[model samples]
Target chain A: MSLMDKMLALDQRIIFALMFIALAFPILSPVILPMNIQQYSRDSFEFADSIPSGSVVLIEGGLGAATYPQGGPGLEVQIVHLLSKDIKLVFFSIGTETAAWTVTAIDNALAKLPSGVAAENGVNWVHMGYVPGGESGVAAFANDIRSVKTEDHFGTPIGQIPLMSDINKASDFAALFWWGGSEGSIPFGIRQIVTPFGVPMTGMCTTNEVPNYTPYINSGQMIGIIGGVRGSAEYEYLMGMPGLALGQAMATNFGGLLWALLVVLGNVLYFVARREGGAK
Target chain B: MQIPMILTAVIGLLMIIEFFFPMPASVTSLNVTLRSFVTIISATALILGTIVLTIFHTKKVGTRGSEWYYSIVYVVAFVVTAGLGVLNVRDTTFLWIYNNMTSPIGAALYSLTAFYITSAAYRVLRARNWNAAVLLVCALVVLLMLIPIGAILFPPVVPLGEWIRSFPSGAGFRGMIIGTSLGIMGLGVRVFMGRQKEHLGIREERRDSE
Candidate 1:
């Protein structure tokens, strides 16, 4: 075979091995790379920062096990940020799996809270875990909190929860933050809560889904969006609490670099083989 | 079937009307109750699905069908996990299963996508034509723009990628969303008017009667 033909026929196992190394190397020993925060992330951070103290805000924790690593750091940081500001948070997840992971994020955040933040459960925050039906469940929860959930995640009755006493519906909250992950339920929040009650909202979605939700931001239905692990790293950076996400983002950079080079190489080989009439 | 049709229409109309019109407290309360039913029904459906899955796998294992060993794995996993979950999902054993086993398995499966995509990009991202070349360039720019090292390697890729995403990709997604919204509205109207019976699991047979 010609050199071009052999190059064009390079085995994909080699590519996979390289990619595995590319993804794993930084995770083993971390490196920091220069990353300018994207506009969408900045908008999301600013929206969270803009919330007034003591104002109640609703959060939809929609990150499942597969998505937790990407959006979890950002969720933890956002919890810390809001709790430190003394903003009351009401969290609910639409999926059973996501609800549990949300609890983990909350616990991690709670551990990192500033001294004397008054983040008492059922008072400063309440997790109405695992609201079942997707959009319909969001609509129901938005319409009447007690209609869907009578108790918090820890099995505390909602009626006895001091934070939930005055909050019966969506309008009671000042803002909405949807850490939607890969659920694609940010639109559910926009439709059921923001559109109906005129509550401003921000969202977080997986990296690829970012483009799909950007129009909502432009149309003003959503204030902003945090897109994937890079977005999470940006959130950590903005909060001045650099964590796992920043290092993970660097790993992503390494993977992307290797992937891009392979693509270019494959294309070059294809063109050369085609010119020599030795390509498929 | 007719009763379900009527109920679907009534509840769907109530929600639509409630959205557009200011309803009295009594009407709002009724609508709230109806919407909450969706959650209960969805949960019931989940349980039903689980039962159906268990039955399918049990029969496979009983009959020694293709990949019956896999069925054995599923049966064991399901029984153990579900038993623990039923006893108390918050129990430490159940939580350990979920956190260690289920969570890691899911994450590993998801990470496999990166490997496949890397190989696929190398093989399938070739530009053999004019339109393909444009797409390839755009994909390259956007990929570079998204990763942290892109700006360090090439500065202009940032703005180029932003323009591509904010305009062409954004407009494409916007168009898709609008189309999907309209399609959903059409489907809702069909369902509400009893023209769509498939959602109710009542298929309309068009075969000739012999």
Candidate 2:
């Protein structure tokens, strides 16, 4: 077979092995690639920063175990950012699994908080826990919190929590943050809270799902979006605290370069073979 | 069937009325109650699904059906997990199982997609025709645009990739959103009018025959 033919028919196992090396090498010894912050990430950061101190913001922690590493650092940083500025937070999750991971993110964030930041659980922030029933659950929780959730994620009653006293509905909060993370449920927040209650929102989703949501950002429904691990890294960078996501994002860059090279090479080989009349 | 259809209509209409109108407190209270029922019903449906799945696996195990060992695995996993969960979801062991075993497994499974996607891109992303070439180029541009090394390798890809994502891609997504919204509205009306009985689990004769 010709070189083009052989290249075009290169074993997929070889490609997989190459990809493994590309992804794993950076994780072992991370490379610091010069990166630009995406406007989406910037807008999301600015939106979070613009929320007034002491105003409560509602967050939908919709990231699960699979997505935690990608969106978790960003969520933690956002939590720290808000708590440091004295911006109280109320977190809830739609997925059963994600609710647990959300706790991990919150705990991590609280652990990393700068000295003397008020990290009170009930008084400053509260997690209403896994609200079931998808968009219906969101709408119900947005309209009347007490109806759906009687207690916080812990065993404490919602009524006993000081944060729940004045905050009853979506309209009560200053802004909404939906860390959707591949759930593709950003629309739930926008439809149930943003449009009906006029609560300005921002969100995060896996990198592949970014385009699925950019329209909402453009239309002003969502202020911005943090897309994937790179987004988490960007948020960490913008916050001037680099951590987990930055290293993962470097690995992602290496993987991307290898994938891009293979694609270009495959196409070049295809074109050459076609010109030589060696391909059908 | 008729009762469910009526309930769906009434509840849906009341929610809509509550959204767009200045409704009475009683109406608001009633809507709140109805919406809360959604959570309960959906939660119940989840339990029902689990019960059905358990039955299927149990039957498979009993009959020694195809790959029945997998059924045994499922049954064992479910029983152990559910037993611990019922005992105490907040138990240290339960949380440890989830955090250590479940969480890492979930992450590893998801990361496998990275390997699959890389191989797929190399093998399948060929410039076979005009449309294929356009898609390939667009995909490459976006891939380059997202990675940090792309800008260092070729600076112009940054702007070109940004434009493609912002304009063409954004416009296409908006169009899809609008189309889907209209389609959903159409389906909603059909469901409201009881012409769509699928949600109620009423299958058509032709569909069943096929």
Candidate 3:
């Protein structure tokens, strides 16, 4: 076979192997790719930074294991940043399956934070567990927060949590930060939680879903956004603290470049082989 | 008459009712219990899915398919992971396999989409139609905007990219959101009201026989 034909006929496993190598290389070596650093990331950090030390910030954990590597790192950084500012966090998951994951994410994040700056569970932060219903739950929370969640994730009553006691309604929160994969819940949060009460909201979402949330940001429904791992890296950079997000973003960019090259080469081979076959 | 379908319809009706009026304390408690039940059911579904995957591979291996080696790799990975998880081995061989082998492999697998996208874009841009040409141009613009070289070549491309992302494209996406929400609401209502009765998958078979 001609070179082009050989390339065109390459086994799928070979391609998978190449991809494996390309993705693993940057992650193992740890190279930080230079990014444009979108305003969304910067804005999210600024929103977190601008909140008063004792102000209540709601961190909505709406993701599951499927999105851990991509969305989780950004959340970890945001949680750390929020804690650094001495912000009081009210953690909750709207989707039922996400509650346990949310609590685990909080615990993982708190464990990573510096000893003194880390949020103290039940005091500095409280998880309100999973609330059933989507928009209805948000509306209920807006009207009477106590009605939606009586118990925290660990079965501690919200009444007992000092940080949650004063947050009787949506208006009490300085800002609401939602971290989730692509789901209707974020928009539900925007409409029922933020729009009606005029509470500012921000979102951290998968890269694929960032564009969907952009209009909410532009329309002033969402104050800011952090898109995927790259956005997380930008947040880490803005905070002057680098973590797993930075590594993941670098790996992603490197992977993107490698993939682009392979595509070009594959196409060139495809066209050349087609032409040769046609001639034969 | 399947237990699962009957339960689903009954539970769905209750959820819909809960939305319309202030439910009694017992009704609300039932709803919460139902939510937990759904969660457990979904978890079981995951196991069922894994079982299906194993059966598919077993068939392939038993039949001596062309990619039997790959099937073997997958089964080994699955068995090892499941074994570790079940045995509660924190730093077991399977955990290492997952952290070292699976995680990176999965990441790499997804990352390969970047290359496919580039090739797809090239082919798409080469199309002769005006709409296709416009799409191709928009894609190229977006692609260039994503990369650093585009900004270095044309500084305004970054803002231009942001504008494209935030304005025209954003409008389309918002339209999609509105459309999807309406669709989901319609589907939910239909399912709750028992208007759409394909839940059992037996209706088609009955129709075919008739």
lDDT per residue for candidate 1 within A1-280, as digits (tens), equals 7676666667878888988888889899888988898888999999999999999999999998899999999999999999999999999999999999999999999999989888899889999998999999999999888999988998889889999999999999999999999998888998899888999999899998998887887787897789999899999999999998998888887888898898899998888778978667
Tens-digit lDDT track for model 2 on B5-123? 99888887888877788999999999899888999989889989998999999999999999999999889878888789889877878788788988898889988877888778877
lDDT of 3 by residue, B26-103 (tens): 997676655555544555666798999999998899899987979998898788788886786344574466556755
> Where does model 2 exceed 4 Å of error?
B204-210
Q: Encode model 3's per-residue lDDT on A179-267: one tens digit a residue.
A: 86655467878877786678888888877787878778877788778877778778878877777777787665444555555655655
Candidate 2 matches the true fold with a TM-score of 0.96
Give the least accurate 10-residue stretch of model 1 chain A, judged by summed lDDT.
A1-10
- Top candidate on DockQ is 1
Error of 1 at B100 (Å): 0.4
The TM-score obtained by model 1 is 0.96
Greater DockQ among 2 and 3 belongs to 2
> What DockQ do the predictions score, one after another?
0.79, 0.77, 0.18
Which pairs in model 1 have colliding backbones?
none
The docking category that best describes candidate 1 is: medium
Q: Report the C-alpha displacement of residue A222, candidate 3, in angstroms.
A: 2.8
Candidate 3 residues lying further than 4 Å off, grouped into runs, are: A1-37, A55-73, A90-115, A125-175, A181-200, A242-280, B1-13, B55-80, B87-97, B203-210
